[model samples]
Target: MAISKSQQFFESLWYRKTVWWLWVFWPFHLLLKLIVWLRRSFYRIGIFKSTKLKTPVIVIGNISVGGTGKTPLAIYLIELLTSQGYKPGLISRGYGGHSEHYPLSLTQSTSASESGDEPFLIYRRTKTPVVVDPVRARGAKELEAMGCDIIICDDGLQHYALQRDIEIVVVDGNRQLGNGWLMPFGPLREPKSRLKQADHIIVNGQDMVLEPDPIQAINHHQDAIKEPITAVAAIGNPERFFKTLDGLGYQFKRQSFPDHYQFLKQDFESFSGSILMTEKDAVKCLSFADERFYFLPVSAKLSKPFLQSLMEQIKAITHES
Candidate 1:
């Protein structure tokens, strides 16, 4: 997971490690802003139509790059909807997957290489119907046909093509819209003003906590082997996983890769110690994982007040639909 110099440079820029040079990209950012405005306007004016599904669609996403706890929040919603006797299905863009066909349906046995890590992890964790398609609307339709009463989209805030009943934006509390500029200049994919249009905004690690489950062996069905651990993550924010491990008093060597990096067996061919990774990455490694490999699963712990309000909103939306 060695990062290229260019990637490192952008990381430094996005996190405010360097700032004075930010003005150099201001003009280009302004141009990008104009394009974004035009695109949104097209949708708003019906020039570009958004597909509305029969079931209520709840979109959990972020306006910035990098991880903001969207997947955990989506899983939380799946549990919430189910508890209310609603059958929920999930749809994703399949960011890292390359399946041979469109509208790929996911099951517990679905390969991460085909459905992508997030969708695969969600399916395994929730045991709910999940679909992946570059066309978000088409994916939602597939979920609807699967007998899902409601649909939850993992990350599709900017995907205006698929109309959503609820738009929940998850912001990284630690890096809330770094530099406040869009694209190459900063972390924001859209302007900060977009937050006002969202149905709700959840600051990750604020009202929510990622509670780790027991360590699970990747290639085995028992407890993880006790040994010095080598922590590796290919998530948008590897530091978050590493920090969680540190909080758990785990001392290990850190190895990070770009977000959604497809793992190969050869990547661990030379590793000698017990290796640990996130559940998202574990899905991709299952085909070639060994006994020494382990993964940590985490459940989202949302505040009661937030959950109550969200559930109420969900009920109101679904009732209307």
Candidate 2:
């Protein structure tokens, strides 16, 4: 399929230098920035009220428009909280989904088309209570009513309506705050200075080191064919995933689709070799996927000090409440 014009524009903003169109869009970018600033100011000044739930809320998101490993970090937090005997629930804005209802609860059986790919994937992997709504604050309320003590919001850094106790920003190590300009002219949704306000700024794919032989890590039982595979990704930053795979010493052809491109069985009919994909894409392919299809799972590897600091913050919040 041909890339959309919007995609082309975003690419120019992120990867290219000194494009004439950027100057043309500069006025619009400033307007958007001013509007965002005013909206945030309203929330800060109580003109636009923010809902604070009794249950503590932790938001995991990125300032940029594209994916920055937020889902994996949310999953990691869920697992961490679970191990500590805390009941954690998740809430998402269901970016690519449309539901007849306002707040939809997700389960392993929930369709990705209805609950959004990330929310359904989280529900499947963690089996934790997951709720999706355009109004994230309402989603948090639903999760709380379901008996959750802590809520992990998948992506709501700019959703000021939901008052979050802790804000965790996930950044792409390779792309770092591209161009450092907000919106149309660049990739940032908020200014780089916003990073200072975040409780934690986690960089994804930073520690990926080249491995000598990644085939040794694959489970032979799942795949008898030891032939080279094709690495496929339908994500915001495909290059990051591709480079990470290369670091893992995987020999594969690269195939990238537009972010969140819905995959059909026919999409894979042309390729015959084994296929590897990201966990996000794998959630959509489960029905059609065979033994040859494998997804590489990743987790946020925060530093020991960072983890300790987070724990202390959570403890303090709980004590005050």
Candidate 3:
């Protein structure tokens, strides 16, 4: 297969030379923000009204485009809520799915082609009701009908049609609002301070150095479990994966794929030791996975006191509702 220029560009976005190009792209990015501002203004003040589902919906997504570990965080939220006794379901836009108009409920046997990779990944990992549709509210309602008490919108940060109670912004801290600009010109899907809109900001794989380190750069790998081998990822920007691996001090071979990447037999073929895969990747890899393939879980982690207070807020909402 031939490599694409977009693929090559994205892969090398971290280089110092790429940093220089942001200056050239600034004007177009300004236009991008102007367009977003106009579009969101109607939605914000209500000309483009949003509908609410009866169930409380929490949206975990990023302002920047591509994989930023929202799926792992979504799965973690499902398990956390499920364990805490709330019945949770997930709703996603089903990017790359085959169907149109009609929403699909994920089953154990759901393939990536029908449900989209992320929904199938969520369903297989969480065993929570998972629904995928462009009409996010319809999916929420379907999951609600299935007795889900709360719904998690997997990646609906920009999908303004659905109402949400808690909004989480997931970020690759390494990229940190890349070139601090918007699409086609920079990396952000929305503005950076727009993070203030999120109920919480969660950073994944936390070891990006502002100053370069020789030894650290050599071993800046993610899948290699030098510490605990439980790794998990199913997103674009595998550099985030490597950065996380560095933070955990783990050593293992990498099994990275493109954003929304579907698993292949060769991924397993490449890694030999006990595998630690992102919860998102775990879904498709589950059949071939065993005890060795332990999935690591993560969720929104604000300041300690803040998180406790937020939990109380969630509890209050649940009780009052």
Candidate 4:
């Protein structure tokens, strides 16, 4: 499908030609702000009840829009906690899932359209319990009943209704704080200062400039060097993924697709080099992949001190009430 006019219009505002469009979208962004404000108000005054899971809940979210690598990080967290003896569960909004009912557990065979791509992918990769619903609590409560000791919520920074013990904010290192403006006018889903509220700021990609090793790895797999290149990203800001690899001092002539673009074998033949891709893109591509294709999986690395602090926080929460 051709890019929608609104998408093109919203997208163009990120570059040097940003001035006038900011004026065009500022009102819409203001409306988003109003919604956020009211939401905060609801939670602040107890109009909205935020439930704490008996097992700790850690949220991985991006302040801006999509493609901050939330899904990959969730997979990493599941693996980390599982290795450490915690039975972790996952909760998601199921953004693209076609289901209309309350949350349901996801399985390896669940179609992306039924459970949403990211949640399905996480289910398939991690084999941890997975639930997707618009109301995060629906998913959380089910996860708790399913014997999940902890729940790691995906894309949940603004999900104030479901209480979280740890808040992790992920930003595309290249986008930093896109246009540094609010939504519509800029890329922020919430304001930039919300970063201060996060227990951790995970700058996805190599240019991370937070504290020493603000990004760390638990069991992240390294991509085997792809000399020539075959790659794809079905994500917002596909170029950011490509540029991150380039900045890592590894070069691959990567392919960029519109966010969530489906892959076909023909897309791979466009390049002769081995194929590399974000794990999200790999899901659809796998059906069409050959030996040339290798999925490069990356996971967040929490600094040791950060992880220790988070452990303490969880312990304290578990001990209280």
The top-ranked prediction according to lDDT is 1
lDDT of 2 by residue, 139-200 (tens): 89999999998999888999999999999998887777877777778887887888999999
What is the overall TM-score of model 2 with all chains considered together? 0.89
lDDT of 1 by residue, 1-321 (tens): 224447656876788764777779888788889989999999999999899888999998999888889898889889988988999999999888889998999865578889888998998888989999999999899988889989998889999999999899999888778888887777778999999999899988898888999888988876845667789999878889999999998989899878888899999887778999999999899888978899999999998988888889888988888
Query: How many residue pairs clash in all the candidates, one count each?
Result: 0, 0, 15, 2
Ranking by TM-score: 1, 2, 4, 3
Would you list the rank order by lDDT, best first? Answer: 1, 2, 4, 3
C-alpha-based local distance difference test score of model 3: 0.68
Tens digit per residue, CA lDDT, model 3, 205-311 = 44211221222111124442344343445567655656655675666656555555556656666455566655455555644554445555344443455457657
lDDT of candidates 1 onward, in order = 0.87, 0.80, 0.68, 0.72
User: Looking at candidate 1, what is the lDDT of residue 17?
Assistant: 62
Model 2, residue 159: C-alpha shift (Å)? 0.5
Off by over 4 Å in 1: 1-5, 222-224
Worst 10 residues of 4 by lDDT: 210-219
Clashing residue pairs found in predicted model 2: none
10 residues in a row with least lDDT, candidate 3:
210-219
**TM-score per candidate, in order?**
0.96, 0.89, 0.75, 0.80
